[model samples]
Target: MHEKDHSEALKARIKSPKRASRRMSMLLGAVALGALTTGAMLQSSFDVGPTPAYAQNLSAQVPAATSAGFADVVDHVKPAVVSVRVKVAVEGASAEGFDLRQFGLPEGSPFEKFFRRFGDEGQRPAPRRYGEAQGSGFFISADGYVVTNNHVVEKAREVEIQTDDGKTYSARIVGTDPKTDLALLKVDAEGGFPYVSFARNAPRVGEWVLAVGNPFGLGGTVTAGIVSARGRDIGAGPYDDFLQIDAAVNRGNSGGPTFNAAGEVVGVNTAIASPSGGNVGIAFAIPAETVQKVVAEIKEHGAVRRGYLGVQIQPISKDIAEGLGLDDAKGAIVARVEGGSPAEKAGIKTGDAILAVDGHEVKNARELARDIAGFAPGKSVDVTVWRDGKKREISVTLTKMPGEKTASAETGEEQGGKLGLSLAPASSVDGADKEGVVVVGVEPGSPAEERGLRSGDVIVSVGGKKVETPQDVREAVKELRKEGRKAVLMQVESANGARFVALPIA
Candidate 1:
């Protein structure tokens, strides 16, 4: 789904309840077998006591089979559920501020004089509106540590949590990991609190689960459903592995816990996919494994530290795999290696497809990113890559990711005939790299323009090799053409940034 659509769906789930319900009912069957007690009747006629054999026989009948219900599970887990209320300072016009626009008066109108007497003509300070938002959370420890979504308490001026027992306590933010949307909070309580632990084993996809949260400000709401799917990537973040459940999760359910039949938290209620702003039997939660790791890190370090490998990677598509002579469209293709990054230091090159990290198979770019981020900085790991139609492993020592950075574009150029582009040495253009050729002009309706090449774009590399001059670009293109390649990949650097463009060689 589109990012906007997912965000809209998540927001909608917070305000509306699920419209569908699945009622589970159970029936019990009882059968009674009686034997004529002639001895007991004769004893009653004689006024004798009841026989011990008859009473023992009556007690030995088969017991009825009992069906499982959620009442016991709810009773056990609901006490730890909490309602999180946040007070945010919203910026807007205050009620005291008077505007002539409200009276439908144009600028410089005669009525401005009458309004000016009531309020100042100059811009008044925007009113600070105190906005309150509600969500759900649960206690993770007895000492008053609670876990919730980061978005629930983010940017809050004041936070308070209400337990199921109707007692409210002021909550302080302990730590938060925005990447996974998880936060740790602490409440000052007198004694040990009821808490739940994360499930050690992952619940099966079809297993029944319970969700308890404050949906739409409804405190202590309970809903039941099954785990619909696993490892769902809803485009939330780099670590997008979420569990999809059919629970009736709605607004105010953020940061709630999804428990398995054992009453262990299997996931944290996060988002839903609903078009009408309500649960449509599809809700997503952060898996227990991810939550456990993030929460523990937050508790220890107050932040999440992710390992970084400096390279821009893209998923290997079937066509890309075919172009690279690969058997399967698996792995992440390195588009560009950041200068001085660990990947560059370890001799990782552009156009190399990463297949595994430390022997763990990486299926695609997202998987690779998640796996790499899970490691600690300064840890060395073996990375397997496919280059030149062969597999090789390289050991790389990870480093802490520096703040946000973007790869600069690099491109190469050659005598443009079929592509129809005018090229010149990049050194000829100001602020352009000296090792590539710059596009002086692109012919209208040509393959160069169609491939997004434009004037002032520098070509840094052709066919994954650096090119300094037009002759170098021509040589690379000639090599690819001799190899019968249909398209040549060029690394292009423009004002926006660096990106790889595949232009048709024909």
Candidate 2:
């Protein structure tokens, strides 16, 4: 995949570049609004869990910044960034026909609460259209080319762009990529439009950065902070190499840009670490290095074609690291190699730990996936791996993404100590039950394993929340932690019947 095309890929997923920035913004906004409504729940959950180690006995308050110099950066970048408003034609069947009554009763249930919260479902007929959703975006080119997250523009019938100066332009989507959540849009505007350029160099950690975006329909808001961290993954997607900044990014700032000291756009301010909609001093940015490449590719091509390596890989854990006889738990460990894949053709085998790709270090599976996906199909690259206590390198040609099949394993190997137990998708055995977590293998002394978890026991719920997939388990844990719950009450299913168990968690 071309570098410029990747951001475009990000754009394409979000909507078009013009609407994507706003789309990505809306996703975060929804999370915030949800959090705000459930703030009390989150606070209660926190009190129930073990206190954060970092906060133990830490009572001193940090002093506020004495200087207001950073405000200048926000003022400089605010003009180029804008709020995007979109009017989407929501089909009546898609929005109204969907049943909300099904979600109300269960803890992990999706819909019942929706009907109850909104009111008597039968009495209130659903609206024919969802009306309009507002978001944010920024200008990238002087010729009126704009970049945003794909989501903001997705499903929108009409889009409008508004700058800090109150100038508005009716926008049109160019293309969108759902995978990366980025989008591109163009407006019929005259030339000589003010635009921001992305910085070429990597912004230093702790370096001052400025965030500008519209927060909750509020226009032209600016906040400042330092780069908190880099390459932070928030479990949002596969390619989550976010630049974590300390800047205060709120709901409306979704598609806005995060700028470096030179006034160049360094990151697309996307998400923040907050239990509430307000900032908690941790925000994420789509790095400029990744953005520039995606933008350029979207400009040239309508879509992004990413390279694929047909293998299911996971992070090397201490157990696997010991089992594999490696020096340390680093790089991506191939759990299963797909048949007839580039890995198979290149002789890459299961248990082969990938160290690097094209000389770039492969820290983990996601990094390897992102790096491999960074290339177009048919591109060949060198891969270094550790097999049988020896380092070996293999050259493999990249393939198309959707063409590769994801392999399933029988062990709960890669999820680490996050979820209670390792599980695989349930497969029907004619007379066997389906639709629950099938415990293939559990770690000895683990919470689940210690609780008499067996190879075939199916988990139906966690802390009264249903467990459907690994994602569900993760969300349950997160919700448990948020609610200050000490133990996760799970309903387990087996060949005989269903029973409940509480798994204690720290």
TM-score versus the correct structure, for each prediction: 0.62, 0.60
Give lDDT tens digits, candidate 1, residues 211-245: 99998886799999999999976655556788989
Q: Candidate 2 lDDT, tens digit per residue, 158-266?
A: 7899977898899877655555567788878764556666776889898888787777777887887889889876655556678988887777677788877667777
By TM-score, the best candidate is 1
Which residue pairs overlap in candidate 1's backbone? Answer: 13-251, 14-251, 15-251, 409-493, 409-498, 410-460, 411-459, 411-460, 412-459, 412-460
Segments of candidate 1 deviating more than 4 angstroms? 1-68, 93-127, 404-506
Which sections of candidate 2 miss by over 4 Å? Answer: 1-68, 90-130, 403-506
Among all windows of 10 consecutive residues in model 2, the one with the lowest summed lDDT is 36-45
C-alpha lDDT score of every prediction, in listed order: 0.72, 0.63
Q: How many residue pairs clash in each candidate?
A: 10, 47
